[model samples]
Target: MSKQYTPREMLEKLISFNTVSERSNLDLIHFVEDYLAGWGVGSILVPDETGKKASLHARIGPETDGGTVLSAHTDVVPVEGQNWSRDPFTAWEADGRLYGRGSADMKGFAATILAKVPDILKANLRKPVHIALSYDEEVGCFGAGPLVQDILSKGPRPDLVIVGEPTNMKVVTGHKGIAVLKTTIRGHPVHSSQLHRGVSAISAAAKLITWLDGKTAENRAGADPECPFEPPYTTLHSGTITGGQAHNITAQHCEFATDIRLLPEEDAESWIRDYRTFIETDVLPDMLAISQDCRIDVAELAYVPGLQEETDGEAEMLVRRLTGDNARNVVVYATEGGIFQHHGLSTVVCGPGSIDQAHQADEFIELVELDKCASFLDDLLEGMSQIDS
Candidate 1:
């Protein structure tokens, strides 16, 4: 017989795997698959193109429509530079909290879901309960798109999705979208003394970065006072930059990465179009004039749609009924909920712990938070069982 593990034990087991975004999560995925199989629940694997990573989805109870999907990502952010007090992958307990790399950010919720699997099976749910474990969520949410597509195509359509992102168990009605972009500028190198004769890639990059900053300031100045987001407007920021070889020579190459977090009402395409137009009309002509080889290229690394507030949304209503949290809530951080919502699934963000602890040194989830989550799942199971098919 398969050994039954409590939620805390399951969490410890999950935290032992070093499934960082840069590393393959196959080990974790395989473990989950084996665990589910031991319980007689079959899972479908959606492997990425490289076969290095995979997403796992399983359904319990009747194969029917109007089901609830519990979604969580298996991968966690890296702990390379952070000054962790102990081994990040090894789970530890102290002061009524469980500490590990992904304890709060996400894996805590996944562990709870896995621990409740036996209860879910025994609930004899009239409606199905789907478990969606995705990969690469920390890095641009790459795995969720394919995972969502696979779920919709292969199985009965679920009525709602609960993305188990750490929200302290509050139901998040909406969240900002994100568009990650990388800009590369190639220019002719020349002596700094004769700078005017050659285009300077670093200078061009600076101009573009300045333009982005100006746009951010413009949005901030005109932001809606009643907006729930902390800054109350869209934000554009350049996170990383690299280029110039030395101070004496005009930079031959320059590259910088930027991300735009847009309010739910905004469209990412509009912003991308505006940025491209600026590059084509205002920035490129001068560089081309100096040398045809001088060029600017903008590549979109990723784009996750904003989760718009649905009027009388099914997912929102269900979570509110379960948690008794009616206060309006939203977040600035992006999540797979937006992608699921974009694909026509009613979605909400709710789970244990706090987002403030995510990706930090010595991350942890309070023991009380785990108990609250377990009670919520128990209530969910009871509710599912009571619903008529």
Candidate 2:
């Protein structure tokens, strides 16, 4: 096989398979599996229950014990309405940057890892380098949960997991945890002329919105004394609200989505309970009295924990060293790192490119960034070699 597969070639192979979060990653997984199998490396294919989408966990050395893992999600968010300058599924590079739907968010890192495997294998270092490419990360951190649980169940989980989310190649020690909460409010619709006869769900939703605004304001006002993040403390936001047709109609239904980012001790569940209490006590009492059918319901769309790298985190320190940086940093976006840590693997978020370029039209990862990543991998190899078998 060719040495150091050109970034173009690696990215070409990656972008050919449309591994959108809503779709299957089988083609991409099969390609990687086939490519790795050729080198006598075995892979474990952990398909989702439906046997549609899949996440692959494969080892480069002895699978018996602890090792270093290079993980990246194979899924990309949908490119539905975005006006792309070119085909989003086809890899194209211009002015030293590769463009595609997942180029920076982040098939580039996955491709880079696969490209680096040859060099890692050739090094014959004491520690094994494992690859964990997952699916459905864009939708939520869903696919990785079960796959990692299986790994932990067998014991001796990987020593560290590097989640390659875009961070301009910086070693990210922390990010906010996210909870996607949806709330639906129900009431009765009647003629606008008979406004008194109708209970408006849109109006109820306004009450819920006010409640959320209060939470956001409280956080904004008294963000934190013990906050560990930038502009830290929990925040609540309602993104979309829809109901009511014509001005004449009293809207009967309103559904809105609210997302919250909580501090570790804040306990998102407790906040959810508090929000439920507000609805049960303040918002719903009047509506329920008029009609027993009126209600407000909340459900979780997804939940992923925050990444908090230890002060002396081995994984964070290693990544910072590998990147040739003297200091580690933090990011605002959540990633798959915390989940890996939750499942017993010391993990940090580090990868090539910038999130600024991620999920944007004509998303791209610059060639310079890919070059820096290759150099980091080289540094990682040298660093790993220092440890005795």
Candidate 3:
């Protein structure tokens, strides 16, 4: 807790907590809350309705908004299957890098912001530097809404928001949206001998999968002819599929899930509408002919919006000034930046480390990247101070 503690130390402290998306981030939240309290800052904790998780919002300057929000997620993705050289939480530093689960994926940025708090406090500020951290961001950006909603409903709107998703020290203003879906196939079971008479959900599900894959391919090919990305198109992919029992017998049930990575202009609901239309127009009628009870159901698992700022948007200008970057980049990954923009705050993504290292085995952030981020924060805080003064 000494002034000599660098952002990396604070990051190491943060990474030590196992705040997986499935677990409560309360411990991490409280730890951060206490840290800010020691620095004479007050925070608000919006605990989940079930009391399992919470999001923390703290301020170093004026409590009334209208300055900036430094936001990052508290939860890290699961590391169950990945092989690691060391404990994912212990935060080992070597080869000029900090290795840990959330090291690069996030916590590092939080630490950078934390390390600068003393400087921010010392500066003559006219506006607040709101520090907002949320849980379940990896799950779907769900936990941030309520916390941000409360902030919006209570006070002045922030001038800008910086979403600290790893971007290799570059200012990224745009990213693709993501949608997850789980589908169910329902039909009547019948005797194995009665192949034609029975409504085979397995067969219907295969047809649906084929149709979906085709739709995905069509969308990918036809979408955004002026694609800015490497693939430059929407991506649809099935993750899990299962059905049927006996080889000779007609199976009654099948279910599966898919993920849709959409372009900025693409609305996830549009994809849903098209899919439902396909199921009704092409799928249901044929199955209904065999049995009246035959049905297909689709459910949305999660939807993360795209951060599609216009060319040289307000967000772009703000980030450009902060990072001194003249070029903007777009990413395929989804982050809370999109959510923040949707909620009315001008948002931009710019942080430390390569996302390639994110959510992987031996995930780590290079010391050079952290140094760059710290320098970024230094300039940002100084800029805010000058404006506030």
| Best candidate according to TM-score | 1
lDDT of 2: 0.82
Clashes of each: 0, 0, 1
Question: Candidate 1 lDDT, tens digit per residue, 300-368?
Answer: 999999899999999999999999999999999999999999999999999999999999999999988
The lowest-lDDT stretch of 10 consecutive residues in candidate 2 is 1-10
Each model's lDDT comes to 0.94, 0.82, 0.84
| Model 2: CA > 4 A from native | 1-4, 225-228, 386-389
TM-score-sorted candidate list, best first: 1, 3, 2
lDDT agreement of model 3 with the native: 0.84
RMSD to native for every prediction? Answer: 1.3, 2.2, 1.9
TM-score of 1: 0.98
Please give the TM-score that candidate 2 achieves against the real structure. Answer: 0.94
Models 1 onward score TM values of 0.98, 0.94, 0.95
Candidate 2 lDDT over 1-389, as tens digits, reads: 44457655787789878988878889999988888877678788888989998888777665557678888999988888999999999988799898898889888888888888787777756677878888899887888897787666654467898888988888778888888899998888889999887889999999988998898888888876655577677788898888877788888888999888866445678778989999989989998777788888899898888777576777877887777666547766678887887776788888888899888889999978888777887787776653555
